[model samples]
Target: MRQKDNGGHVRQEDGNVNNSPPPTLPNLPSRRTPNFPSDPLQILRPDSSESRRAQLSEPSRGRKGASLAAVAMTKPQQQSPPSTTATTTTSPPPPPSTPPPASSSSSLAKLPLRLHSLASSSRSLLAALRRSPVTTLVAAFFLLALFMYGEDVRTLAELSIDDYLYPDADFYNVSALPPLLLPPPTCDLSRGRWVFDNTSLPAYREKECTFLTKQVSCLANGRPDDLWQYWRWQPNNCSLPTFDARRFMEKMRGKRMMFVGDSLNRNQWESLVCLVQPILSKGRKKIVKRGSFNIFYAKEYRATLEFYWAPFLVESNSDNPNFHHIDQRIISPERIESHAKNWKDVDYLIFNTYIWWMNNEDIKVRRPNSTSWSEHDEMPRIETYGRVFKTWSTWLEQNVDPASTSVFFMTISPLHNSPAQWGNPNGIKCVKETLPVLNYTKPLDLNHDMRMYDLVAKVAKNMKNVPVSLIDITRMSDYRKDAHTSLYSIRQGKLLTPEQKADPQKYADCIHWCLPGVPDVWNQILYTRILSKSSPPSPHPPLPPQ
Candidate 1:
């Protein structure tokens, strides 16, 4: 509201229209605004509607008639003694010294009446809001946040299944590339719910996976739960085929399929190895681990399924699979060649990198040519991520042969470190958990989520020739908070014992998925994609050249 100055020039109440709409006022949004508002999302969004509403709410806008609340704001309170019963004569109020000439316009006459009604309504709303004075100036912020998230989600709706899988940056110019090795956009496999099918055994028994690392072997580690292993991800519209180990091996006869990322990918790699291990005899297959590479070779088919530990997917000190410290994390984003040379020519390439890069502070990065390993520059996370992908995308354009190679990006595997995510405020991280989150409709995620899918999707879109299909296993995996290798898993290369399991907070491994569990479903989805189109013959006649 404006007041007349001694010199008669009006000044703004707040010379500060706060730069970003001063934190939303206590839910100023009232849909029951029949007597006042007609604009949409007005209280939150400081556009023309809000500006116009503010004008009507101001007492100065209607000098002829001030609202009840407006008069209270302008006046000060003073305590006085109770009035005595005494008759007193009152003088008539004086008129203004210089009254304005009367106007004949109906708009001027009717304006104050409308403003009075709106001002009263605004005062009533403000009074209700003032009862609970919070930091927020408006309640519409929650609505705005939902609207934004809703908008961000629908951006993908423009994309087809092929586009979702194999994003062509130039959505208009897709014909330049060869045919994508994905099924037509019929039913979205990513948008699905989990099903309980304890009717049969899981893809593989825990005891039979001889090569399964003890880190992910929860059942063998002596945990008491098994319901996490029985659930299968079922697509809402389409019936996915069961994983056939023999058929999958047959398709990759003389080729290589590698899972290249962090331990989560290693978790998937172990799941895949276990899935197909039963088909071959012991002598026919063997797993070899040397430095960062873990290979499981099939003697008969000459096929290899491997897992490479490149958490950052670039040159980094943490590349060594055996030993790496979380605190002393470092990377050379522009130099991926050290690790790229290993899995560059693989027939089926599955990639994932997220959890390792999620640090609260800036990341330490070194230049590729630096001789002194001690010298480093601290770079922000997202910037470093962008540079790493830029190098990776450049490498893909130069090295990968789209005709022979089918590239895949496994989406970020979700972690269940917070019990509050699943509506259990009292529970610990993935410990004593039995079943997968059954209710898909419930808000089982954190209010403040850190999803890197957008960045991954953006990077995939910018690729020119290479068609990297996204095996969108994030949302589906998010429901499996029960599937993580919690306290039942390993710590520092050894499994946790009974006494150690008692303290879940210090020992829980929520980042990695337990075998015969979530990763099996990931493989099921991967298997679905694998069966869609047969792989082309390996360009290098017998895979890794003799």
Candidate 2:
């Protein structure tokens, strides 16, 4: 019989050296014979799945020699000759014997193979990332920012899909944040400062030698007709034609207009109605508020003209007497959104909020959401106002759609209490000056007024699609120096005391315009802006109350 290779030592089969030895190793010098069980030679043959599993279980044995690891993993079919011989059927045995070559080790030796190289490179990258976390995170953030910048550019170039799908959508227009629209505004320091001096006043050659004084003796107890006639005589150059009660009634016959603001806003609204109500035969005009906040509907024009007195336009606690004066109580963006639902769906949206925000030391508005200012607060008034308006405009841009509605931001209605601007620093208290007169030697420095101008421009700039027009009544109205009700003296209608009649310019009501007075000029400008194309002669028959 041919000598059989015992299960005790390494066997050489057809030039292949396979290790399937007994416990004894020739390299070991210890010759003491310890009775050891015969090694299973068949285990190395890979003929049974159990043997193959057993072989993989010993990673150290599998990795003994570099060649053994390579042969065991690569060309496993050829290395495991017994298994190849055992499987005579078309399908080969599960040769999971080669543990599918672990992803880590084989990837090490076969560094030249693209798949292995890729795996190795990935591991190296992971290790490198672990070493420099900050740098990796910063690089990732930079890349993300670059991606967002590109996305913004794309958004500006085309209408976003969200725009069309949500027609009533109120998305803030980022473009409105820029100062681009300010330069193009028609009213500004240039026009406002241009005063009509003794020489420049001649621009108008009046029929009378009475040298049209921009100032006129003001009225007390309100004379509607005289107020109407006075403003027509001195219409601001930038403004539209003077108010014609008859004509305005006809023009606004069926139209609806609204003014929304605080008590001051109501002052103008009441002045406007009084001036025009006289033009209507008694029962033709009525003043009514139907589910309207501060709105006033006049009977003659059939116009539902009204005023909504939401100074901030956001709902907040009104119970606190100081709520109106406290800066901290001012509504925040999140708070404003809570009330945005009520402001929508209007033909023309007019907004004004200034005096309400004039919170100074000792006067603080404390909203549950906003913090009260302390001595440590250092923010500028303009900055605070800018931020507030920014939030407001952003919400406006997001909620209002220009396609169906028109938006307007009226320039802050100037208060006549500023003696320097009204040409009466000491004696005049806005009550004595009634008639239209040029009392100021120069145009008032409008730093306070320009804040509103700049804000409107800023809002217009950042807005997209919405053509927000500015009703710049500030500069236009600034020219009427004597128009204020100075010292409460009636000029054109009521009889006055000898003392009152003697100094007509001393007792003027400075705050409100003589409706049928200068404010009519503002309304005319508004009309020109809205109804210019048609320029319907002031509507006849007056608007009926709605």
Judged by lDDT against the true structure, how good is candidate 2?
0.44
Per-residue lDDT over 76-95 for candidate 1, one digit per residue giving the tens place of the 0 to 100 score? 32222233542344656423
Q: Indicate the TM-score of model 1.
A: 0.64
TM-score for all models, in order of appearance: 0.64, 0.46
Which candidate number maximizes TM-score?
1
What are the runs in model 2 whose C-alpha is more than 4 Å off?
1-229, 233-239, 242-255, 271-285, 289-292, 298-303, 315-334, 337-340, 359-379, 418-426, 434-442, 446-449, 486-509, 533-546
The global C-alpha lDDT for each of the candidates, from Candidate 1 onward, is 0.66, 0.44
Q: Which one wins on lDDT? A: 1
* Residue lDDT tens for model 2, 1-546: 222111111111112222342122223232232221121110111123443333333433332323333533463222222333343456756553333355334423343354554788878876887899986798689778879675444432222211111122122343453321222224332143223234322212222212111122232233332332433423333433334455555544554456665544555555455545555433223343323243333333344455665565544333121123333443432356644544564555666666555544222223343453232233455665666566677777787766655677677666565555554568444544444444446556533546646876887777766667777677656666555444433333343556774563444445554333455455555655664433333222222122
- How many steric overlaps are in each model, in order? 8, 81
Q: Candidate 2, residue 152: CA error in Å? A: 51
* Worst ten in a row by lDDT for model 2: 4-13
